[model samples]
Target chain A: MSQLDQSGAVPAAAENAAPAVSLSGERVLRVIVPLVMLAALVGLWAWYVQAYNIPKYILPSPALVAQSLVNDWPILGAALLVTLKITFAALAIALVGGVVLAVLLVQSKWIELAISPYMVILQVTPIVAIAPLILIYAPSTQVALLVCAWIVAFFPVLSNTTQGLKSTDHNLLNLFELYGASPLQTLFLLKLPAALPYFLAGLRIAGGLALIAAVVAEFAAGSAGAGSGLAFRLLESQYRLNIPRLFAALLLLCATGVAIYGATSLISHLMLRRWHESAIRREN
Target chain B: MSSAVSMNAVAPSGKPIVRLEHVSKTFSNGTIALKDMSLTIGEGEFVSLLGPSGCGKSTALRIMAGLGDASTGRVEWPTMPHDASGKPEREIGFVFQEPTLMPWATVYKNVWLPLRLHGVSKAAARERVMSALEMVGLDKFADSYPRELSGGMKMRVSIARALVTRPRVLLMDEPFAALDEITRQKLNDDLLRLWEQFGWTVVFVTHSVFESVYLSSRIVVMAARPGRVIDEMEVDAPHPRGVAFRTSLEYGEFCRRASQSLLSAIGANDHL
Candidate 1:
């Protein structure tokens, strides 16, 4: 083969047609289109509000929303930080709990039989229904809200991780056993690594839901006096008929959710980029 | 079982290294995968388990590898060496029907798995892994993932992983059945070269007449429906069997006889 290569026997055509990864003009347009559309929508909303002489109370123009955002930066910023803290903390707890439960469930059939039904039940029961009850009995409002957010985030991680652990290639497991690998070796070397994509997928979903649950729990608790999160700001704006601030708060919430998703997705991509098919960049 | 040995037919290089004594395997699903199968593989001999799809060829190979237990009888591995310290012990190397690589890992890591499982660190096992890859002519692809390789290349990596342990016994279950004819022929040649270099006992499973004839020094013909060995044929061919040997009249003669035995075994199995 080396001789053939030196003699130029390998045809250039036989070389694989790998996808070009450079950001060419066509690639730039894919990113540009979404930004252009978003600008157009905002531009149109501003024009419509002005042309129709709409009252600010009913629907504020995009300019007014921006102004509200600028003027209320301190309050909204604090609320944003609070919500972010709750979201990430709840997500961290959920991740640890879910993976632990999933590992235990996979370790034994009896544990899965004993607890899987309850997991399904926990998933089925909407967090909103029990947020108020949790708030009333819990020692502190923040702890109650954290518990609510955790409850919302935990199920997806548990279920996806469990499925991923169970989905390890049977032949690989047999090979491990043939080499006399202990149970712990199989779990750490085979099962957990295999579960990574599933766990990341669950984290992405849980990221969004944790934010939603935090806000929902704040609304249910009605405990807003200085240390509340973005959801409380949203509720306060709505009750006080502060339409522009409401839109501004909603805008921040949406942006935060998108940012959280982007971060998690970026993490997933970076970790799996080497081998997983999902993270691999391919030709269009 | 030792007294009933059939060394009468084999022209193997050495004494029996592995002997299956009245081995029968009945799966929990009530399927009799193998019944009363007996065969002996000599050291440094290239043996093929050739039969139809559902025959117990694969089952027999798995039993020999200690991956599956026989419900009745036993497999005697009298020549399997055991030493104290056992730090670098090389037992049996297995290649399944599929490549069975850990897709999440690179080729180096995949090939490094058996050693890794045996408590050998990656840094310590790197030299062995690289040499094994070089043996299969895939040393350059060590950093590449299994998903990036062609079907034949992936199978080579699988073989490289199997060779990484430097085992005394090699068990392959139809390892080339998925490849194209040209690729299969190329792998057969490469495998023959490796076998000659290493001189390990090989129990290869396959369903192809020409492949079995071209590769094995001895071919064990098996059948389904209570899968069992029905006949065994000695290739009586020289070492380093090349493409010329594959096309020779002697090769054709052995294939014809093996094909007849396989057919008759299957026909007889249908009744039992």
Candidate 2:
């Protein structure tokens, strides 16, 4: 029997009035409200700079920050590229390593028990404390930053994917058993596909975390040779008392974080749109 | 009726198809699912294991299919012309209560499962798959996914999958229990037609008294709590049973008698 009601309009009406009430409208509000708030904050800053007649060194105006961004475009852009390179490299490593660890964890209980405690310890430990030690032990600062970021991003994917792989439907599992499918066949066909939603969710979270870890690690472990990332630029600008340049660098970092979140979410949506409820919710 | 036909009676080609002797199953959880169950389904007999929920009817079917172990029994079968004696026979096909069609696979591929498992080439199995789909009247919907179909259509695909293997015996576990009254009756008729067409013996498990009465040549009534067969009834109704047969006075009387027997087998405490 069909579960669809006679009046198709009723479900739609309920959906509109209930949880999705503000969801779509709130997305527009989210963008509009934040932009309005940013404008007001900038307006207040500009007024304060002129009213109090504060020096540019103390608190630069938004215009001054824009000018500083233009003036140091070449150097700052290079540093931005460096940070992006490290972030992406670390993310790639984390993705591969995390999935392998998750697969191992699923395959053997002993390995999961032995390694899980260390993974937790790695996650909880501060990056600042480990960066210098990694820098000293590792050959280069770039490698050290990559390792730190990998450590930060690895756990979420590993934990999420492991749980997803194990969360297959019992009825479906019995069906597979009835067919006389081998363990490996079941894992590849059923477990892997079932785990995809969770893995994508974890990847989205890890994308932002990986970027944060890259920046944080650079702050602790000094940048070598070609002048490191946005974090180094931030610290240098602060030391030089270049307020406008510091604000511009901070803006870039925030933009990078937002981009990572948006891009990963898009990837997740594209991959899961056909079968998953999460993607279906977004469709309406 | 007193002819004393050989328990291992040879088919027209001189071969006994399936034999089960003293089959019983006790789950590791200590539930006695079946007790001293023995039945030899001939070439094309439609035998229904009519029982209540916990009567081990399904368990008995599974044991015949080799999907589960009989804690204490032996099942023997003559090696078909295509099979070697050294190799285990894989001719039995099973249809579960829930249409266990693969959600990911299309109807065509789902029906092709048994053949694929035996390493049969897809190209060679294509005709057989289509024929099986045709039998279920679902050949047109072969490319459709299980989720795209109705409950009745999905169950039809499940039956098609079982039939595709050209299995000698079909073991069904309440295959029509999930469908509506109309759909269930239609499927029951369709199932018997398939059984007759292929000349395949069916060991059907069902809770419905009317269903067993309508489709079975012989009905084995079972009782729960260490489930065992309590009574056996042989329906003398002729083959090619039509829709009108279900509404006939004889069919209703048979159903009533079967229901009474089932109620008594369930014990005096339980109400229908």
Candidate 3:
């Protein structure tokens, strides 16, 4: 029943300073174990490729895919740029549309009530089912792809920001009233700042969704005309029985997703690092 | 009963700064927050509404501050002689229980809120903001955000924001109730100093019997259920009440009398 030391440090004067080294050693083990496990998986994949005599079309080796990615760099790089453009265009439209919708909804409860059910329907309905219909009616494949992605990514921002705007504290509202602040002032100063954390969270979620939506829409629409992207390249590689090329296109897509996530989280951190609880340091 | 001199004495002749005549408030949900209450606060009197919770003290203060309209009575203010249009009066400042600061705003910007709302340019409002911050002893922290400050400091910023308008009357609803004892005591002293220096009427609401005795020249005890004023006590102690006076027997006697009146009000409220 001795009192445990709560300083979160080992006594430097004690012989048990060895525990600090042991703790850091445990941290190293924690990192190394995961790396070793990943290495084992890679070794097993290589071994299986050699032992099973699987055809390249059936299952290409990671090294072969990497090689093919380098070999077909010009085509894949063009596809990557096209895919990035679609993703960013769709995201920009979604951001603007979602924020406008959120402001409309917050300003008028009747509008929110009338529009929310349809917004939910759009959110829940499959984008794949809608993409072909959009392609036919949209006049342009690029517009169709952008619309599909915007539909997919816009709801989270709208819903999150709406909730955030509505979640301003009652006391704060009273303070605004006491100061004779107009509705616009209250919205800009109090509601918008209060809603920022929620909006950033929604943006992070929407960023990844926008990338997925762009890829999914391209997959469904067959990338006809000048709207070709990574998904079109994936389909093209598959049709040609170029498994390595397909894998390469997929790697690009995965990298895009990861990059979108990383960039959004960085932006969220940068914008919120000052005043938000989500970004505040917990320790003194 | 209808003598002119007595009626004039009852209702100060120097153009009432704020007059609540038979004011009543009843929520739509059938809760009567305030019963018919009549009160007039003079030009520079420091009055405290002393009551327990649910007594509608805050409601009363809000009515005076023009945040809420009384359901059954008229609130009147004397037309300022200097006003050209002879329209409704302006310049009332309100401080709530919570600091209610904009977290994203620096202290200087927070204090500038009222003036900014009134369409005062930043350059024009800068001096007033600085003076208000200086009055609250927060001149050094004007650039700091509310989140970076302690609770007491945040409340100081709230006070500074309220004072930046230089309102003729200051309505405070338990602004120091959330602070620690030491901070609360210090603020009470500082508030009186500011009140004396500005010569502005203060209609403060508080639950603390001791605070009402120490800070207010006049205490109005209120009861709930149908919130109404039960008694009014006058503290004839001189201004610039020091720390020594707080520890003095006279302070204790004043607190006891105020507490007795407050308890009786609460007791009367309980019977309802």
Candidate 4:
């Protein structure tokens, strides 16, 4: 895609040849199609529950879930705040730590050789398995949950950023050397900017994983109280058999996941829209 | 080859600014990229290392630029200025086969890079960067990103970046090899204009016989398979050579001789 843009004329000609109406149609379809599919799926699920007269505990109707969503807003909202706090905090920490570690690792092959094995172990080990250990060792339940999320989210940023740093255009590296740039100058002006698209890509992946890790860690900790996240509330509702409220909490989790994805994608787009291929909008 | 070594001292008028004395480069994989290559580039001269692929033309250029070290022999910059460290200062600009601009940077910032690395602030480098862009006819595009430009435009940006520091010598390794013929010819003319205007010694590496004949003051034809210089010829054409020269009898004659040298260079490898 970047190659196409770099060559310029061929893609420009192709872009101009594309009809304007179809381009606008594509823009419209992008949003409308997904919404239409979502509405249809919800309608089908609601209809099936109503027609079958399914028990509320067995399968709460969409309307009943919506009612529960409104009625239990204060409780669910607070739980959501707790989960969001953990997720964002973990993601922020992972982003900074991961990038710093990646830069250090790329500085020497020996450093990378020493540290990458441990990073791989962290990435491969299930958060569920580690969450209990973290909970036992951590000073607080929140700290444990944050640790779990960080473990899950940090690897992609580190690995992808490392690759990006190493993959800087060889010619540019030589050029920088020719100009007598210092190591720090090369890192900041060249490698960091070159690695940004990769970092953002990792951030997008880490964003989703952070939320997942937060939920999973909360589940594993299972500490129920006013400070508990939605995951605990989910367990509590399940044990109580309040299915509609469970569905409401589940809906909130799904919404939060989408929001995180959307937010990260927006960040990636805004940062890279002017240059990176993945972020640049191509007409078809 | 022995005769060509003697010819290394035969600069037209100006002093020998850069001299490669019996330089040979062997890669770690044990491929000898260059073997006993001897060439002399005079001040204000436009010399092209013309050869087929694997002829180590780019390698020789890189060695001169101090981007690579020769396994045997030495590169001497007899006329370059010395820094406080007593080492000859790196007073060379290089353009790769690819434009190689940072895609994220605007054209202005891309041109400002070498100056930035030299500890010149953006405000200090602004006028120089703009003038470099103006030389490439891209001053209006200072704010544009590389992706927003065409192939020729990007290459122009690369040239601007190389020129921003006002180096004493410009080393180009097939910088226009990827461009279309029309754009290539236009750049060839523009490059000649710059060379004439600044009087910077230029060592352009290219495989095209016609391009070498058209643009060079001297063409050093090289052969592949442990690449070595095989022949040297002077164009000796008058300055301000343009489209008229490209279609002239003298241009055709130079092109024919350069083409024969190039074909023989390739044929020499085929026999081995």
Candidate 5:
């Protein structure tokens, strides 16, 4: 969602000076259907709870969930910060590691052949299977959690960026050669800029993955005392049978994921808006 | 310098800019792109390599630019100067079939690329960059991206970029083939004027007889299926070939003869 929206809205949007008054029926339907569905879902949930006289332990009412969110603000907020920090740090580390590895990989065919199989093995191997191993090796639980998150978040970035780098226009490569451009000049001026869209796309995928990885790792770590993240909070709420608080924490995580998507999309828009076709708005 | 080209060395300078001596290129997969080709380009000559697709017109041009290796023979640059590195330094500009502009860069930056690679700072290259754009009549669009320009405008930027280095030899591979007829004609006239102004040797690759006759002082007609040159013609027409010359009797005569040569070149394939 972040990649698509940014690619569309970043570039050529300034040319759209006129405010469109005649919204098409399809566009209207797109907005109306999802919103109507959400309202119906919440209404059904409320009605079902009241009509069945369901207890709060099994499933909290929508109103009760909202009340829990407001009431448990301080605890949830701290947990949200911890989760967000781990997620963002892992994402940052993945970005640098992935792009650097991609650049080094593309420098030689031998290097790529030697390294790619291991990367594939890493990608295919489940992170859950490795989380306990990482916990066993690392001195701190935080480091172990970060390692799992980093492993999960790094591949999409490396692969997409490598594909982008390799796909540099053949004609443009010829052009660079014709101009007698040095290899370094070609890499920076041509290959890197060409890889921007792919990198940002990778960033978008990695953003959501970073969040999920952090949570999963936190679950495996199972830190119960203080300084725990939202995932641990979620496990604690479940063990205590605090269903409403669990739902509230789950709600916060979902909202955080959406926020991550929104942030990546905005960055893509700002960076690619000037010239990329994906960011351009054509007159239909 | 003679790494791949066959040894047929001779470089007598006065009139000729470069000599192609029995050059042939056959790909590793056994596809012959150019075979036993030979041609001599004179200084300040507006020469067109005119033939159909796969005729080695482009392959011949690439050999002259030293962009491709000729498996059979040599390309002798009569006037190429030797640098301190003991290699003949090349000062050549090549334009491709497409505009091939970097979409991310502004038109000014696109024109400035060659100079930038040559270690000229942007501030130092500003005048030259603007002048190249001015030659193509796109100075006003210096700051605009390639996508924002019309097709013709983008090609003009491509031309500006090629000309930015003030190369002694300009090689183009059907640079205007994708444009509409009107834009093609306009660019053809503009190109001729630039040739006259720059005093550079031009080896233009095109299939259009009218374009070749209108622009060239000489046309080298090529045949395909093991691409090789089969015919050559000297167009007695002068520079400043305009709307009047395009419709004139002599222009038609050159076009007619050129067309006949082209047909025979294509006809060579029918025999096979």
Candidate 6:
């Protein structure tokens, strides 16, 4: 009687453990749902423009925007290349600078106390507010725009990496000490590896911010030439009242931002999939 | 109290590995973690610093490991080889209460850490790392990360990491305290086996009386509230202690006496 009761009790938990939906079905729903929503939104937009017979200058139709994108490909494409160059250059510099600064700051309390306040001051002040000063001092408009993007993107990396360095496991530190590890060894082998997840997290956030800052700084600089970025084309298109070209440029910027985010997320996932909680897949 | 029970055989017959003489540690905030705690761990001895929480047993173990220094008195390692800097070489390995494995690293890499720090190349240290993992029965899980393993397996990885250096002195601060009873017992047996095979002088810090009795040839019972040693007792039972020893009448008697000592140590703090 007791054995039968025990056997009967096991099935409730077993039933609860079973997943409600198949894994593949759930995965298919995730991808399909978003594409469906996007299609519906685009269809509504196209219908609304057609019904109103809106002027191209006021609000370009999806077909007109697509046509403009094809017609203005040379100009807009070159501008995109310029903007991407500035964004990536600034981000690379920021990664190196932020990580080095964080490592130096963590080395001594006094160094951190003296320097961290300045970093905070820089972070809190608006980038546009400082863009004019940067433009005046910089040798070229490209350098000025790069500086602005770097200033915006670097703070998160510095702060997050600093936090990661400081939060290293105390026992592990002691273990390193017990092993008679040198300071450089501790920094590279212990602290750096421990701080990787935080650095990657900061990088993901900074990726989007870098692109935004690059465009905003260009808007502030308002420098117009063949070497000008997408921001300049947007301004030029607006001034000419070529709203279709402006919409096409705007669409390109949105795609670039999404691409940057997706790339950063993929990097973070690939780096951390083996160990980090956020990246690892759970059984259920 | 009985013929089998010996009074304070604190120092074993072998040469001393490390000695803490009148060591006391007070933090900057003025809390005395340890007070006048003097103990000597001889070579090839398994000594458990048995006490309740806040008793400075872990503090004492840390001092022994040279992770922290005593505010007063001194810790001496008389027999160990010294490095070029006139300090003792990395002759000691420590296992913390937690597994403390590098989460990002594979089991093979985590176990490889101590040797890597000592400037040993991967190719050179590979054999020893594998052997250490084999000792802990986790050789098959070498490529797995700490997150992938069970609690016991992670602890085993930690043990393997500590052993990779092949240190003469092994210091553990309640290393198995978080494990389930079955896992803990299994680890206890594995640890004893390693100690016997390696002849390592182990200073194990634990709060459990039963655990202290089971593992240690000598048990140092300590009191908290300023953290001082109150009693020392030796378990005269023979080694290769396993399930039969765990359930034996002799083991029960040792546990009973150790429990009494621990209770009175706690009782003494209550009186204060």
lDDT of 5 by residue, A134-253 (tens): 999989888888888999999999999999899899989988876677899999999999999899999999999999999999988897666789998898899999999999999999
Question: Which lDDT value does model 6 have at B79?
Answer: 88
lDDT against true structure, model 1: 0.85
* lDDT tens readout by residue for model 2, A1-284: 11221133346447646867667887888799989999999999999999999899999988999998999988789899999998999888888888889989988999999999998999899888888899999887888998999889888999899999888777567656665666787887678877889999989989999999999999998685585899899999999999899999998999999999999999999887644779867846
Total clashes, candidate 5? 3
- In model 4, what is the error at residue A16, expressed in angstroms? 5.9
Against the unseen true structure, what C-alpha lDDT does each candidate score? 0.85, 0.80, 0.83, 0.89, 0.84, 0.88
Could you tell me the lDDT of residue A245 within candidate 6?
98
Model 6 - which docking category?
A: acceptable
Top TM-score prediction, candidate number: 4
Weakest lDDT window of 10 consecutive positions for candidate 2 chain B: B1-10
| Over 4 Å off, model 4 | A1-21, A281-283, B1-4, B7-9, B83-90
Clashes by residue pair, model 3: none
Per-prediction share of native contacts kept: 0.49, 0.10, 0.35, 0.59, 0.43, 0.57
- Model-by-model DockQ, in order: 0.47, 0.17, 0.22, 0.50, 0.39, 0.38
i-RMS for every candidate: 4.6, 6.2, 11.0, 6.2, 10.6, 9.5
* Residue-wise C-alpha lDDT for candidate 1, range A1-284, written one tens digit per residue: 21221122133224433334343665788789999999999999999999999999899999999999999999999999888888889999999999999999999999999999998998898888988789888998888889999999999999999999999999999888778787999999999998999999998999899889988888888777778899889888988999999999999999999998999998988888777878865323
User: What TM-score does prediction 6 earn?
Assistant: 0.94
In model 6, what are the clashing residue pairs, if there are any?
A: none
Give one digit per residue, the lDDT tens place, for model 5 in B121-234: 999999999998888887877998887777777888898898888888889999999988877887888898888887888999999999999998888888889687777788
Better structure of 1 and 2 per DockQ: 1
Each candidate: chain B TM-score: 0.92, 0.88, 0.91, 0.95, 0.91, 0.94
lDDT of candidate 2 over B1-272, digit per residue (tens): 11112322222222446666777789999999887766666677788898888888988877666566789987776664333322235566778889976665688878887777667778889999999888888887777766557788888888888888777878889999988897887788888777767788788999999999999887878888777777777777877897778889989988987898798778832653
lDDT of 4 by residue, A212-271 (tens): 999999999998888999999999999999999999999999999999999998888898
Q: Clash pairs of candidate 4?
A: none
What order do you get sorting by lDDT, best first? Answer: 4, 6, 1, 5, 3, 2
How many Å off is the CA of A261 in candidate 1? 1.2
Worst 10 residues of 5 chain A by lDDT: A1-10
